[model samples]
Target: MSHHFDYPSDETLDISDAYCFAGAGDAHGPRTVFGMNTSPFGAPTWNATGYYELKIDTDGDYIEDITYRATFPIGSDGTQHVQVEQLTGAAARDRTATGMIITPPNAPIGQVVECQGGITLFAGERLDPFYNFIPYPVATTTALKDGTFPDFPAAGPASDSFANTGVRSLVLEVPVKITGREPVHFWATTAYFDKGHNTWIQVQRAGKPNMTTFFDFANGTAKIADYNGTAPTIDLVGRPAHPATDPATGIWGQVRDNIAAVVEAGGTYDQLPHAFPTPRAYGAWAADRLLPNVVKFIPGTVALWDPWCDIQNGKGIIEDIASNIIKMIVNQDFSSGLTPGPVLDYFPYLSTPPPPAS
Candidate 1:
């Protein structure tokens, strides 16, 4: 799962996005759920003031064809009100496009609005569903520095770093008919209306869990912000050349080098014998799989993110995403060894927010 605080503190927008698409058996009749959670969850007021959007690319062009956006406005009673909109075609691609409102603007947090076209929307504080071993980042950094992979048991009984914490969440579930049966790619963004610039400034963009946090650990604030500001298409090609002396300006190069450093240090060449000859060769191959970091889901099928699963369609809220990602990067059966807590089985499926600390 994305830590949501991956960027520099000044540009911090703590929207960690996760998504899943369930089969026809669901009461919603095959729906795709997009979940966004923000940090420092239970406050006197909602922390996420800006709007969040789920971008869906239906035609496989890596460009969004449909967008479901949620905006929050604080009411006089100090509760946050949610308004959801559906944008399509040019509007979906354009940040300034408002499209059409699908849900009633007066709907407050915890209230489920059944919009036209069978869309269900909810916005409120919820227990963050992301679970990871507390020291995973430290372990990864250690691997980069000393070539030692994390030993789950040695980390002192897997502990969930996000347990009991909460997040301001915007969850939207749309019927499969809206996205059709074709495979679609999904990513999310957090943006604020910049009064000075007279345009929306996207502060964060997330798709695959932990892509920015894990692979781009070596990059500085500017590079991290640039990664969040851009689209998946740019990710696939690569970022522009850096002004610095380092020629590894492209995202692929950076990702490859980072992974290669760990593989070379750990002496894990035997793990991927087919990538052959050198750790860099394996790194390059792995980079291809990790780039263009969007979640792909074929509607009407259950979504899962297991590395060994033949089809990793999409990421479920409770999926062990951290473990799967670690296993992929190292080409080993690594695990976070921390299990996610239980969540509700119905609409707005996340568990209720934990009570505020005394």
Candidate 2:
């Protein structure tokens, strides 16, 4: 349920979503995770020139609290080594990578590189962890505009279409203490420093699942690259905040309009809660799902539990949005397919890929 292959390059293909698993481990008093795919669908090189960043907000304000930067540098043997750093203070914008731990990427699908600062790093090919049955292209191309999108209530449980696909995943297991052990929001981005330009340009980013798959190309229009290049602050909150009637402003604004248009034209209000009572009310509730694109992980909890969903469920200001829409899309059934097989009961929890088809 993400913008897989929505962007125009290998760098942006299949960047599904930032998947979170909390209390999956407790090697360090309690651990939380934030993982995503980068340069996922090709024989791409994660060599010395690229940067993978994970940003966290501890204060619930949606601002970056600490940034964790991961990079791959070529070693003497010409193999890529994973190096990570914690960026605090002004280093987030300044791009200063301090506090370093260098190690090789995971190997044999079972080896996890235990890095410094109670963090574990794994970068390798793994079975795509995300699972769902919706055919996005079919849904968006034919139904969204025509207002014939499938009805989840009437439809049987959707199949898992991505069951066999693989992604170049970057997974991190960070201790709660480092993250201040509170409710924290996290997102991932891929960037590289341009030697000629002497600057960093973001090429890919993801926070909430399905942002690109559903909203970026709302109403049959493409904001793929524009959405990728914009920062979360600007994308979620406008350059200068304004009323809902303002022009299609940022990413969420465009998405709200897109969903509202579809909701209005398609008469899909029956899909939303009856409490909405009206189309406008439903649109407003549906639109609130898109802002502050990040995953909220309350430390030391089982993932998808009521408490976890509670903290993650409350809608904050424009600075934040809960994971309710996706949760809601699942139709109140919480225990199925959230994290199917391929979950190892240890560090770097994704399961090893199946052996090649016989």
Candidate 3:
């Protein structure tokens, strides 16, 4: 079996990406969107049974500062219920919701549900706005599995496979005051309250666009459940000594060591000093970007240098960084796939899925 098939499980959570962007003209308000592509063809709807959580870590510590838990009870006619809870400090255990129920508009296709206090919520299918060269994945997966570790290059005119596909999205719009400060981080997950264990268990999660797609989980399937269950605060260094490793004692030291080995063995590209001092430094830097599993949304800052561009927060810049690292496996550039579209100006912000082929 191919390494790609060997790892990454059954794609129970094909989350392409999650986004947080500033609202347009204050009419829409600041927005956070979570997207997931269901696997196994036509599985149960995400909200049909369990909890879909949009977690925000406001302080850059990779811990949840606010958690929005959206639940769809078995008996609901069609409406979904959501609870917003704020967490504080290092432990991040405190959770308190304002006792609000955010309802979706009657019609979901283009409907935007405005909850009390200027909060808006939307849930349904929309075109997947994220794009990247399809060739990039093929090249990297081959290299990582074969241990060749060649230099992957720029997109070179490659197209996006996901461009025509759609992802189920959960969007929330809130006032600026709630976002706290600039450079806010966001991630999303699906969890179910397990009656047998009497605890909420996470089945899937995503943060930065391609964290799990590239990084190796040394322990593989043994620790994958733990990886999903835990928050992103754990550093990406080495295999955890056990499945229950603490976030504070994460294996960052092991990460640096692994990077040293790869760099020394000529498995990775040379350092780009603007980003890091050495390959090991770059490894740690990349780990920080990936492990947090949070999207950094910077308000008032133009992430993409284009005209009439809505704030992409840090998504564009992060995609660029992800592109740069991809060059390590093959020197291709896929920037053409990252163009802006009409989706930026709409209510359910993603672009419309490509029409079915004749």
What does the lDDT read for residue 101 in candidate 3? 49
Q: What is the lDDT of residue 130 in candidate 3?
A: 57
Worst 10 residues of 2 by lDDT: 314-323
Q: Cα RMSD to native, each candidate?
A: 3.9, 5.3, 6.5
Q: How do all the candidates rank in terms of lDDT, highest first?
A: 1, 2, 3
Rank the candidate models, highest TM-score first.
1, 2, 3
Give per-model TM-scores: 0.88, 0.79, 0.71
Each model's total of backbone clashes: 0, 2, 17
The 10 consecutive residues of candidate 1 with the worst lDDT sum are 238-247
For model 2, residues 1-358, the per-residue Cα lDDT tens digits are 4456464454533355566666354655777777776544544566357677788878777777777787767767666666777776567655644644444342322347776677777777777666655543335434334544434434334565667766677788888778766788787777767789988877666776566656544324666766776666765553224334455456655555555555555565555333334444444444554566677777776554122133353111111112234433222223223334455666566667645656
Clashes of 3: 17
Summarize candidate 3's per-residue lDDT along 100-196 as a digit string, tens digits.
Answer: 3445433243356666556667665666555556566555544444444534354255655555665556677666666654677777776655689
Q: Which stretches of candidate 2 lie over 4 Å from their true place?
A: 12-14, 24-28, 96-99, 102-110, 134-137, 140-158, 217-220, 238-248, 270-274, 305-339
